[model samples]
Target chain A: MTTMPETVVPDTGPADVPPVPSGGVRWALVDGWTLTRRAVAHWVRDPAPVVFSLVFGVLIVLMFGYLFGGAMRVPDGGEYREFLMPGMFTMTMLFGVGHTAQAVTADLDRGVIDRFRAMPMSSAAVLIGRAVADLLLSAVSLAVMVGVGLLVGWAATGSAGEFAAAIGLILLLRFALSWVGVYLGLVLTGPSAVFGAQTLEFPVAFLSSALVATGTMPAWLGVIADWNPLSSTATATRDLFGNPGVGGEAWVTQNAVLMAVVWPVALLLVFFPLSVHAFRGLRG
Target chain B: MGASGDAVVVAGLRKRYGGKNGGGLDGVDLVVPHGTVCGLLGPNGAGKTTTVRILATLLRFDSGRALVAGFDVAERPDQVRARIGLVGQNPAVDEVLSGRRNLVLFGRLHHLGAAAARARAGDLLDRFGLSDAADKPVKHYSGGMRRRLDLAASMILSPAVLFLDEPTVGLDPRGRAEVWQAVRELVGRGTTVLLTTQHLDEADQLATRIALLDTGKVVAEGAPGELKARLGGDRVEFVVRDRSRVADAARAVARLGTAEPTADPDDRRVGVPVAAGATALVEAVRLLDAAGVAVDDLALRRPTLDEVFLHLTGRPADRVEVRK
Candidate 1:
């Protein structure tokens, strides 16, 4: 306190000593887990969003499966509930984009992302943690939707191995969409803007074969629906579960399993890098 | 790497956002020596936050040399991050997590072990007076408590330098006082802090040295008293009973100081900067009485930082002032 701060020119002290350096993939993994715990803590503190997600999925299934089952027509003439279950599963994965974008943008608006960037932790930690957390929650909602489907007399007549494969494909789409959400979150400005981005999910889900067969639609509309990534996943899952509404002549629908794998893989390839680039460009 | 003893050294720093909102630095230079509180005082949109962000390694500047804690911000940002903590204008803590949990969470991110992080969180909760509400979610904490929690989080690693970008922007009086006290405590522990504030009095109260930043560049830099002294040592002002006598009073007071006296006819006030203190005030009073000027009010006071800022930047720092 006695010495003039500008004129002191003192020797190096403890404050000048830097902390031990952190590096490599190991640190990134550790930091990612730490941030994942942060997301889990938020879920523990406020479970409303998680519960709402589950209830919403079940509500959609009930409204489509039972309410319109008799009136709705399956392409191959089967039970409407059976046709609706796989579409509902694919819809669950598609809706995850909204959640991912909202969470990312909310953190950005609140300055939490800036704080994470300022820390000495690995840069990839924030996005990785977000993806993992969203996937975990998505899995929970998927299971609940599956249970609701079973309650409505929807069954997977395929082998258990095929059933697991269907689940994997659904999650793969979700995982790819999470990156898309992350990119959208990093770019969108405010809550209203994020809401606007989330609203786009409705058109995407409805236009695809998530609720009805593309065969019943107009020819042009059917062509668009068959090419939709959501339709590909839904069609592939229907094939795996041995459910109804599997009739389609288009190349994408005919090779549904291959398209299911290609679509999410393509989405990941495009959006994963895009999300990272957007996150880094935030400083600029 | 920096050979200088300064905690932060920024020279010729320039950044352009290339948009309608052009709030970026042109050519700014600043030097904050180790273990001192340097207040970057400015009005809104003066690039204070930009400078702090660049120095904190959270922003990229166009071209400049910025070194924090002996590491260049551009070349060795990771090293700078290892040695610095930042409390942005917004409270960045997790809203759903408790204050203690938030601190512990930050500690783990800083790479502290589980037990170490918990112990550090406990210590910070006690130090920041957040123990009573440690278990409660941060969303439940009041504005002051949240700001305090933010301060506590920034201190988790006890970094060499701390960048505070308007730490008390929207806080109430009590909240502002609490933040000021916490900042003073940080300085007492020998932490070098570069604090940006829109309040001139805040700079006066907390800064060892104050840098007047305006329109993206530092217009003036010195100790608070030195800055006040630069506007001339002291001022003796008198409000006359009759507006007609304002000039008469000004003329009488003119002979007492080296500078010419300024008379405000609307307010009937005459003021002049003076080198001497009580004797100059007494001398002006006797001269005014001899000149038949009836005085309504008068006082001899040192120039406030607001006046100093007004003189340097051609504008007041802020319209509001805190009474000394």
Candidate 2:
């Protein structure tokens, strides 16, 4: 294309920006905190989705607690609501993993990740910030589930210490699952990933002992259900919360709490670096 | 920092995507002096976006050097990023967040203190005429408002150099004009800008210097006026009313120009480049009348960028097929 040549346009804005001061840990933390707050602000400004997810999780709990409660019989003759609470709590934490995928993918598709990468801030801050925010939300969501469990006549007969330990295990799983979210977000970009995660949710949750007793199932299916990673946390929570349904000769049942901690730790070891590597690869 | 005064300098930049994809740079070279708007003009697959991506440190090059704001893009990318701002082809701001919140979020990510980020966000919102809509979520914003908010987000640090890649790719005429005015204000503020666009008129209106890229190469580079002037004097175009007399009319139109007249069988028209302007027009009309060639329309027009693109690249500018 051709046109007239104007005189050289002058620079009038500020020039010679001072070099960005470099500090490793402090800057990363600060950047991460800022991004976390940004995510929180997003939730606050548009709470519809957040509220919907919370209500939806509770709705599932209520449906299973009341509607399906009469049909499900625990092997130990305990209230189905009591047995279902631990299973549902574990499922809720695993379900939070899907949110991580959705959030990460949304950021990637919207190019927010690109903007963050272009900045000179800490590279891990964006992913870490997202995980931290989601973890905090998971805690709130778990509290709501626990509250719903109490209203439905579900109680932990264990001590306060055991209850605290059970909550900790559930949240640790949530934390690990969030990194899975981060990895999936980067791997499967765009709006479709949200629906994909939603579609995979029920199958993943049901394939374990979250809502049904492994002892009531066929031998092969029961063994598989007992060994599912989510079963570690569900069995551990049942034990820690003084609920029913924990009978197996395998070491996984004998050491439910230990597996609960180990499972998420193993997942974190795998997904944390993988997610960071994916984040780093975006610059390419 | 670059060894030269140019805010941006690139040499022998090369990249390849391998296989049938086939869209990357090949031995590209460019220079934009400090504080001037250099229009990177090209078609869809001209590698204009790739060049900007390399300079912005968004994509790594296989070979060669790119310097932005005096810092080498590959070696000192962080420094380059601190000094440069990029507005990509699509609007990247968050739709769920308010316009003000989006700018503030970017400011915070850049490591500005909370108060400082807020102040800058407010300042930018006002500067870009977004104060009226600052409190509303970006989803409520128009195409133009979103583009302006994107500009505001990129300006969070008042970057020394700003790279706008097709800033107005899908806006209406009024929106385009609004963005053009905003760009003028940005240049007036002394921020050096590099604008890449497919719209020739956009480049014509904004760029002080034009770099014509085609198929991953800098095919031509100069001031827009210089490029047009280099094409030589005006051209005489006329269509014959009677299709059968086109050859007779071409002979008539040929005698009055500096070179042989070219005829288009489809339009039944003929065009000739001539050194003489009005005299050539009168001479062509007289010659055509004497030959009894019925004429429908005739005129002498200056060379537009459309003709220049055709003259240099041998095709229209918009007919490029972008490859993934």
Candidate 3:
């Protein structure tokens, strides 16, 4: 007892060490799905934020639809409420990028991401699950904005199929924006950085035909607005919804539907892989 | 334990941050016998967390072989992660979720079905004394409860080896004891633990073997009592009332130890660093009496691990105060 008094126990330890199979593609897919479910589970526990994001978009829509709709002149005697629906939907999707960024950074700072890293799950599951969950949340937020638009007499006069396509465009924009969120979250690792990243959303959305017609702006500014991806989606969504939108002679407005699909797809092609690559280098 | 039962083994482990001479491990080696707790004792920045990180497969070491549960950490990280659980220096469980959900989330990640994950979550909640707070958000729990939940989250699968880096750091005494109790329960169930701590008392209380690390290297490795014995049993110290008599007492006690006794002028004390139990205690009084150095008070104090660290490294283990 005088020397080395601590009791040392002997054990038969677990030998359930999984083999490092060169490829576990199916396992990775299953694991990625499970992690996506986990990300969805967060919504169940904290639905307020989910609800608040929806309501925040609704509040913005209401503000623009009524508070400013009467004073603001709609192009060609078109209802301002009708002109604002597509822009609000695009703005709602853009705002979701900030939410995703903040959530990702919070997980990183709190070691939640570290927990997943230490596990034997697929590496891509972390970002993929988060992106999927954020996409779903953005869809809900867009739906809330649409409900607000309908209440204010903003009619989608197009066919049911056109409405579905418009929704698909909004969600596609959300998916691309979420990749930007994931990249910024892994790289910045600070709440303030999320706010800084979100600051870009306003300039990008406002410079376009989102809130107003690009024709109302100067020629140079209007040209830049027409070139914006948000403008493409907003103009395309308005055309598809049969809402009042700028009928420009320019190629971008004329081909709004194609550019709407092309822009978000291009963004996904660039940022989705970029964010995945960024996640791989996060340890550095 | 048999050689095959060593749950964790590191050989020639080296890592550097930035370029060179940045805070990281440098050619460190360690071994933990199965089912026994190995306390990696060191001050802050002593590479404890770094070593644990490498073993847990969350880090890439510059050059080394780290084996966990008999799987090479680098070549077979998936194999290693499948068997090992890491309770990091910070709690990693989600605060927004209830303790129960947190456990189930980990269980599901480990590939347990929903029914099995729910059952395991229940069992862990009971084992960790978190059943009462299982349904409450973790943000509502106390620090101790959160740590217990963190431990529970890691043990969802009864991992073969668990790495807890400074688990009790920043915990209150009650909280620390609760965590220690939980750790003890895990160890009793045949889980090997690699615990990094700065508290000497904590190592004494929980570790089967203690590896004292300094500047990313194991300075000493042994049982607590064995390390204490290295300083030669007990410390014999006395203070003289008269300042003038301090020098005479120091010279008298200098002959007692293998090395010269150290004198503290501020306390008017001279202490013999090494003494073989009570026999030297008796001899020290006789010698001081013979040297005409009257002592105000004299006693033989058992040397603590802190003293052993000071004796071995010529520096006190900074931040080594009994934290809990």
Q: How much lDDT does each candidate structure score?
A: 0.86, 0.84, 0.82
What is the C-alpha lDDT profile of model 2 across A1-284, one tens digit per residue?
A: 11112443333223344657543778778888887898888889889878987998799998998888889988767888999999998898888877888888877777667777777777788888999999989998899999999998899999999999999999999999999888888877576867687688788788788889777779898788778779999999998899987577777777878888998999999998999888878766
When 1 and 3 are scored with DockQ, the better candidate is 1
In terms of docking quality, model 1 is: acceptable
Candidate 3 positional error at A42, Å = 3.7
Tens-digit lDDT string for candidate 3 (A1-284): 01111433222221342433422666566666776777777888778888888778878988888898888776756888898889888988888878888888988888877778888777777888888888877777777777888888989999999999999998988898888888888888589877888898888888998998888899999999999899999999998998877878899989999999999899889887788777756655
Which parts of model 3 are misplaced by more than 4 Å?
A: A1-29, A36-41, A71-77, B1-3, B19-22, B239-255, B285-298, B319-324
* DockQ agreement of candidate 1 with the native complex: 0.39
Residues B1-324 of candidate 1 have per-residue lDDT tens digits of 345789999899998777634457889999999999999998777788889999988889999799999999998888889888899998899999998899989888888888878988887777777888899999998887888888878888788899999899898988888888878877888889999998878898999999888878999999999999999889899899998888888888887776988888987778998889799989988998899988977899899988988999888877533321
In Å, residue B129's CA in model 2 sits off its true spot by: 1.0
Specify the highest-lDDT model's number: 1
Off by over 4 Å in 2: A1-17, A21-23, A217-224, B1-3, B238-256, B263-270, B276-300, B322-324
Better of 1 and 2 by TM-score: 1
Candidate 3 residue pairs that clash = none
Best by TM-score: 1
Error of 1 at A197 (Å): 2.0
Per-residue lDDT of model 1, residues A65-130, tens digit only = 778777988878889899999999999888899899899988998988888888888787799899
True contacts kept of 2: 0.45
Q: lDDT, candidate 2, residue A198?
A: 65
Tell me how candidate 3 scores on lDDT.
0.82
Instruction: Estimate candidate 2's alpha-carbon lDDT, on a 0 to 1 scale.
Output: 0.84
**Sorted on DockQ, highest at the top, how do the candidates line up?**
1, 2, 3
lDDT winner between candidates 1 and 2: 1
